[model samples]
Target: MSNTSRDAVLARIRQGLAAGPAPLPPRPDFAAPVHPPLNNPDIVVAFAESFQRVGGEFYYCESLEQLAVQLAAFQERQQVGPPYVWESDLQAVLQAAGIEFLADEADFIANADLSLTSCEALVARTGSVLVSAATESGRRLSIYPDQHLVLARPSQVVAEIGDALRVMQERYGAQQLPSMVSLTTGPSRTADIEKTLVLGAHGPRRIALFLLEEEENNG
Candidate 1:
């Protein structure tokens, strides 16, 4: 570079350095919600509507008996074989209802047609289910198989993601948060191939959630 050009560049550099650093941004209000407010009066209803809109099957069961009936009908309608269930509580309930499932690990690995498990919480606004490593369902049951089923109660429904997060915080203290926390809003889908949307490209093609109302006696 010529001496005159070098001097000009050096002068601009010095001028820029003369100005002080930019002011720091204002601190955010962590207590206040950052996203759009979720104003649903009934989170369970909101969750069910949103979940179905996202191509998920939602069953609102007033009792365990109703859940069993609805689930059996769903299975028959879909023509899917026995589901893979691992949770002891879910297994017991299904067993009592005469609903058959494959609980063997080898069977799951060999034939993972559908998986049934419990979730931590359900987000109403986005119709997402929050699962953590703390929950047994957070394992392969949530992501593997062609279809995924979740069993939860109305008490676990929250108005929004933030509310669901607070529920988790209360469930597992800060120091003991799960290693893997995920929110599943719908079935796995991608539009990467020829810009045409494809379901179950990488994960379950179908998703189902059963919300069982808490029994009055239990509450």
Candidate 2:
């Protein structure tokens, strides 16, 4: 009886297939509207506002020299000693400014008062910094430190997440993607304990972004 029922079901399926392909529904018209690309000035403003709203601090530096000055001030204010840093152009700047940084070692991240690293891209729409395992900082450096400082250039800022992903794809290609990617919007926080909000519960209590803007030449 089971065999007979199976045969009947198969026969019905075959009959339906023999009836030719079913007609597809008509495609919708009404062309989707396209949003204009955000200008650099607007993108900068939006990113700063969004980032600050989430308890993050934003600083604008006109050049590498300005960045160095800001970092010196920040280090003094936070009283951080030998911040943890990965290999990047910022290292030279930090060194020139006499700002000592711990060697890029996993074990030193927890003891360091602050961690400094470069980000992949800055999302203007959400004010998130995208980082990947391919970077020297790896996956643990950003979260383990008490304070996180990101060094980003103005050219790295994008309008949205899709734009940031596209930048990554263009930079590394799809075939050779990083092991992991993280989009951090702000310092870690939680309200799980008795509904009282707390910062640094899971990660850094303070997150600061320093954006370096280069002066363009008309000549």
Q: What C-alpha lDDT values do all the predictions have?
A: 0.84, 0.82
Candidate 2 lDDT over residue span 1-219, tens digit each: 699999999999999999999999998665853554544467878788878877888999876567777888898898877678876776776775566777767568347678888889999877899989888888877888899999887788888899999999999999888988889989899999999999999988999998877435101
Worst 10 residues of 1 by lDDT: 210-219
Tens digits of lDDT, candidate 1, 1-219: 999999999999888888867789999889986666555567778788889888889988777678778888988888888888878888887776678888778767778888898888999999998887776555688888899998888889888888888888898987788988889989999999799999999789999998877757223
The TM-score of predicted model 1 comes to: 0.79
| Segments in model 2 whose C-alpha atoms lie over 4 Å from true places | 1-41, 96-98, 104-110, 215-219
Could you tell me how far off, in angstroms, the CA of residue 192 lies in candidate 2 after the best superposition?
2.1
Candidate 1 lDDT at 118 equals 88
Cand. 1 Cα-lDDT? 0.84
RMSD of each: 6.0, 8.9
TM-score of each: 0.79, 0.76
Error of 1 at 70 (Å): 0.9
